[model samples]
Target chain A: MSALLELSSVTRRFGGLRAVSDVTLSVPQGEVLGLIGPNGAGKTTLVNVITGVHPASAGKVRFAGEDITRVRPYQAARRGIARTFQIVQPFPGMTVLENVAAAAMFAGGLSYGQRARDEALQHLRFVGLAEVANSNAAALTLAMRKRLEFAKGLAMRPKLLLLDEVNAGLNAAEVDQALELIRAIAARGVTVLIIEHLMKVVLSLCSRIAVLHHGELIAAGAPQAIIEDPRVIQAYLGKRYARAQAGAHG
Target chain B: MKRDASIALVLFALVALLPLSGEAYWMRLGTTMLMYGVLAMSWNFIGGMAGYPSFAVAAFFGLGAYAGAVAQKFGVPMGFAWVGAGLLALVFAALLGVALLRLRGHYFAIASLVVAEVLRELVNSMTGLTGGGMGLNLPIPAMASVDAQARFFFYVMLLLAAVTFTAMLITANSKLGFGLRCIQQNESAADMLGVDTTFYKVSAFMLSGVFVGVAGAVYASWVYYIEPPDVFDVLYSVKAIVMVLLGGAGSMFGPLVGAAAFLSLEELVWRNYLEVHTGVLGLMIVLLVLFLPKGLISLSQRLGRRGKLR
Candidate 1:
């Protein structure tokens, strides 16, 4: 399949620091690409660059063959790139249905009426949040809020959905449910680039995993190959563990 | 939504009967009440809906007053001049919003606060056009009797308030309103959700300015004079914010309720404590904020909940 999103040597800088630098990556159509990194390795920054929250200071971003390097956040949404914040961002006073309805109405291009509500309800139901659809989003538990984010992302009608540490702060069972939801979303053919710290979740869900170390792409391959890569291992587990693994392998 | 619209219509009709009471003092009070209603509701579009604490109401109001007064000096009919003033404020707000709205929260408020001062200076400098702070006079609307003139201006303000109310109702139910609510809640999230936050904010700012602009124009015409200090008084902006806060910021009836309550309090305090009315008004606002932080609408809502519980 053709690449749905292509980044060529993308770099984002803040003052004297480079948060994301010289990362060339392509997410092919319908692939759930895992973006794994250590703390401050710029996983979230890369996502921000893709979504035009912080447009790349250098290089290009192409979505579906159109260069969107300089598009604003709203334009990026309209162009079908939706992202879930690592910390779930919901309109606190708004009901869950209204929160999702905003996504359907704006990014999904649905009219602001019963149709938008109906669409929001469907996504809520899909995420098992239909029961709390009328409750204020701020009142939701963390697990429910994560599910709400999924519903919102889905309501955006995104061709490429970026999930930022979606499984963070969830228990094992909650992570499994979230994993199942991601699997179902992938089954529906939406390409996903998920930032994850959970190696198990990344290994099980991603067709290909890319590793970031200090704002650079260190490895990009199948999950199994990525796990065995010394560089990837070093990036995550430190040089000591990587050296031990190399010694054992030899 | 239909019920709210109808209730608003009924309330407006009841207010329209003020001139029939035959009390000139009450009629004048009613006119001022309606003008306050227009300002409060206009502020609600940005301050209440979009959650932008804009203190630029005086800027728009003063601009409109001047625009209308100047147009009248050049022989423009009063009705068209009022509309021209509204359009001018709308365009000014759109342009201002693009730049001013880039700052959020306290920064945005501070930025908006300076706009009226800037406009005041500009008007003061344009001595040839604005009469160099000497103030400008409008043609006295021709009528057979003084009572007829009072009724006419009162009705005009009442109509302007009604139009503003209708616009608020329409906005409250529109996509623009929903987007604005989203922006108010989480602006960055709203942006990611494709709400076109900048456009929504600018639109809200324009909505907040337009009716106030027209009201200012009407006020100028009603009073037959306009001066920088009188028209560009920062108190107008403060009063609009206070009224919206007093009413319940986002609800449809909140601003109107707040305006009525505030005007009544102002009138009562002025009559009884003429020497220290401003102090009394400040104390009352403090008490209201302490007790009814959500405004008067929440009082009804709380009571309804209590009644259901019983």
Candidate 2:
């Protein structure tokens, strides 16, 4: 399958600091790609570069064969790139259904009113948030807010969905439910690039894994091979831990 | 939306009967009230709906008053001049919003607040066109009598206020309004949801300016004279904001209710406490905002709830 998203030598700098440097990666159509890195590995910055929240300081980004290197955030969304913030961002004054319906109408190319609301309801059901559809989004609990993010992302009818630490604050059972929802989303042929710290989720749900260390792509391959890679282990668990793992495996 | 529209229609119909009283004093008060309603309703578009604290109302108002005055000076028809003022305000706001809306919150407020001062200076310097700080004079309309002129201007202001109210009702129910509410609540999320934030902000700003500009032109025509400090006074901006806050920000009837309440207070205070009216009015507004931050709409709703309990 052809790559749905291609980043060539993407670099993002905040003044003098290169937050994301020389990172080149791609996700093929319908692939569930896990992006794992240690803290300050620039994972979120890389996603920002992709979504044009912070346009790459250098390099090109191609989405579905079209160059979208300098598109605005709204344009990126309308072009079928949907993202959830690392910290959930909901329109607090709006109802949960209104939030998703806004996504459907604006980015999903559906008309506002009944059609958007109906589509939003379907996404809400998929995320198991149908019960609180009419409640103010601010009233939702953290887990529910995370699920609201998923419903919002789905309502955008995205070709590429970037889940930014959706499981970060979630508990074990909530994580399992999220994992199931993600698998269902992937089954529907949507490409996902999920940033996660959870090794279990990375190992089980992702067909392919990419590692970033100090703003560079350290490794990319099948999840099993990636977990055992010396550099990936070193980057995540330090050089001493990598040696310990190597000794145990040897 | 339907209920609000019908209520507004009946209210306007009753207000339209003011001329039947045959009292010039009442006519003057009613006209001034309607004009205030226009200013307040216009401010609601950007300040209340879009969550942008704009202090550029005086800039648009002064620009419109001058645009109409200057156009009339050059022999343009009265109706065409008012329309020209509205269009000029729309264009000016569109350009201004692109630059000003980039700044959010306090920064945006301060930036917009300077616009009126800058415009006042510009009008002050342009001696030949604007007659400088000496003030400009508008030609008296060729009406049969002074009473006829007063009645005509009163009806004109009434019409402008009604149009502004209708526009607000339409906007509050439209996709544009929904996007604005989203922008107000969470701008970044709205942007990621494919709302063109800049576009929406500029549209709201334009909506806030167009009607106020027309009303300004009407005021200039009604008064027959306008000076830079008189038309471009920063008080216009402050009063618009106060009126919205008084009634209820972002509510359908808030601006109108606030305008009526505010004007009545102004008239009453000015009558009884002419020496200290400004000080008293300022203190009263501070108290109103402090005690009823949600505005009179919430208070009425609270009262209605209590009645239901009874």
Candidate 3:
């Protein structure tokens, strides 16, 4: 199948440092691709580049065969690309549903305020947050806040959704619930490129995994093959050392 | 929301009936109160809804006055002159909003303040058209008497206030209002969610300017005089902002409530202790900000919730 999103030699630079460099990747339509990496792997920056928060320094980004390297953030959203921030940035003063409805206003060719709110309610229900729809976004717990972010991104009705560490800070049960939500989202035929830290989620949730190390794609394959790759092991040496420390104490 | 709209409709009708009472002094105060209330409501579009904290109200107000007066002097009909003034202010505001709305928070507030002051200085220097520091006297269109003239301008301001109120209500549920509230809470997130922040901000700026400008036009014609310091007074912007804040910035009825309370307090202070009128107003604002951070509307909402609970 043709890719829904294709990045060709994309590079992002912050002054002297290369945050993302020559990263060419693609996600086929109706696929779940997990992006796994250590700290400062430029995973978030790569998503930023795709979502138009940061301009690409080199190369091009294509969505469904159209060049979108210079697209503005709102234009990217309007063109059916949506992203969630690693740090949840809900509209603090607005109710949780209003936050979702605000994003939903631009969905499916500009719905009226009431219709948009109605559509947003469906996304909130999908994320299991209909109960706290009237509560201010700031009052949500961390897990609920992540669900809110998920609902907001989904409200855009995106063909491609980029999730940034959505499973972070969740308890074991919450993580399982989130994985189910992600699975349900992908089942709707939407392409998903998710950045995740949890190896358990990376293995089970994603059909294919891409590993980034120091702004470069170290490996891209099935989850089991990526886990078995020595390059992936060497790239995660710091993580291995930390794991070794935990093991010795136990 | 329904309660707020009903209250607004009642207010519109009652204010429209004010001139019928035939009490000239009370009618005049009523006109001033409604005029200032419109300013508060107009300012709320930017400061309250969009969270821009703009001080460009005085600049547009002054520009509108000058445009209307100049048009009137050049043989435009008196009513049409106000429209000319509104259009002039609208164009100026769109340009200024584009340039100045880039700054956020305190920087934006201070920048807008300086822009108004600059417009004031520019108006002062253009003596030939504006009559400069000497000021310009408007030729009161052949009204029957002083009361008649007062009645004419009173009706005009009353119309502007009603329009502004209706506009506020419409905007409260409109997509623009939703976008603006999003921008106010988190601009970047709003942008990511497909809100054109720049367009929403500038549109609010222009919308705020049009009403305030028309109000200035009406005020100029009412007094039959215009001056740099008087028309472009920073206090006009300050009072408008304070009224919005005191009432509850985003709530539909907040501006009217704020304007009524503020105007009554001002009149009381001005009548009893004219010398310290400003000092008392300043103190009241300080206390209001400290005690009621979300303004008087929050208090009413809390009370209403208790009533429902009971």
Candidate 4:
């Protein structure tokens, strides 16, 4: 399949420091690409540039073959690009149903109230949050809040979804559940670019993995190959991987 | 259908009986209450729903009063003067919103307050049109007797209040209302969900200004006097904020309850204390904010729960 999103030579800066520098990445249609890195790898900065939350100092972003470098966040959303924040910002005062319904009505083009409600309910059910639909978003547990975040992005019906650390604070079982959900999301023909630190989730869900370190990509390949790459081992896996590699090489 | 019928019935009952009841003083007081209820409700549109506390109400209200006074000076009909004032206020609202809405949260509030002060000073300096600090006086309508004019103005104010209140109620449940609420909750998230935050904010600001302007027009006509200090009082804006806060900032019925409670307190305090009435009003606001940060309506709602945690 053709690439769904292409970031060519993207760079972002905050005063003197460059957050993301000359980064080029691509996610093909209906593919789950994992972006793994140690802290401060510019993974979240890349997401910000892609979603137009922050303008890139230098780069071109093409979505579905159209140059969308200067598009605003809302315009990018309308063009089938939606994202969740690492912090999981939901409308605190609104009911979970109202939160998703707002996304459905505004971004999904559901004019009728009943249709919006139905679509919102469908999204809630998809995220396993249907039972708590009437509850205030502020009342949700962290895992539920993450799910609501996903449901909110899903309500926009975007073709390209950016998931930012959706499994950060979950327990082991919750992590597995989230992994299943992420896989299901990709299985629905939606392309996903996930920024995560958990190797288990990345290894299990991603078709291809990209390792970033100190604002640069160290490796990009199939999951098994990326885990075994020399640079990836040096930058992330460290001494144990070095010893294993030495034993194999010798 | 049933709810609509009940609402219509309540409105009809209020309209048919309120003017006929009791003494002239009560009637005048009732008119004042409605006028303030209108102002409070209008403020809630921007401050409560859109989560932007604007302090430039005096600017819009003063502009409307001045517009009416100018129109009346040019021999415009009384009804046309009100319309002209509303349009002028709408224009002022759009201009002021463009400049002030760019400042978020507390900065927006302070910018609006500064703008109102600037407007007050400018109006005071303009000797030719606004009559400077001494203020302007309009000619009395020779066609109507004093009592007839008072009753007419009361009904006009009542009608304007009803229109404004109903419009707020309708819009609060509409798509625009949802968008405003979303903008308040999370501006960036709302933007990502396809809400035009700037447009919604400006529209709310303009809508609030239109009602406030209408109130000012009626106020000018009722008193048959227009003074810079009276029309441009910063207290008017404070009263709007106090009423909305007391009533329930975001609730539909909050402004009405707030206005009633506030005006009644003012009347009682003025009758009893006279000298320290303003201080008493200030104290009441402080106490209310201390006890119930969410407002009187929410306080009552919580009271029924018998201290159950929210």
Best by DockQ: 1
Tens digits of per-residue lDDT, candidate 2, B1-310, equal 8899899999999999999999999999999999999999999999999999999999999999999999999999999999999999999999999999999999999999999999999999999999999999999999999999999999999999999999999998888999999999989989999999999999999999999999999999999999999999999999999999999999989999999999999999999999999999989998999999989888989888888954
Stretch of 10 with least lDDT, candidate 3 chain B: B1-10
- Candidate chain B TM-scores, in order: 0.98, 0.98, 0.96, 0.92
CAPRI verdict (incorrect, acceptable, medium, high) for model 4: medium
Candidates by TM-score, descending order: 1, 2, 3, 4
DockQ of each: 0.92, 0.83, 0.75, 0.72
Candidate 2: stretches off by over 4 Å: A238-250, B307-310
RMSD of each: 1.7, 1.7, 2.7, 2.7
Give all candidates' CA lDDT scores: 0.93, 0.94, 0.88, 0.85
lDDT of 3 by residue, B1-310 (tens): 5776798788788878888888889878998998999899999999999999989888888888888887887888888989888888889889999999999999999999987789888878988877888888888879798878778878888889989988888887788888899999999998899888899999999989999988988888888888889989998999999988888898888888899888988888889888898898789888997898888778898888988944
Model 4 CA lDDT for position B164: 83
Candidate 4 iRMSD in angstroms = 1.3
- Which candidate, 3 or 4, would have the higher lDDT against the true structure? 3
List model 4 lDDT by residue over B250-298, tens digit each.
8777888898889999999889888999898789888987888888889
> Residue B142 deviation, candidate 1, in Å?
0.9
TM-scores for the candidates = 0.98, 0.97, 0.95, 0.94
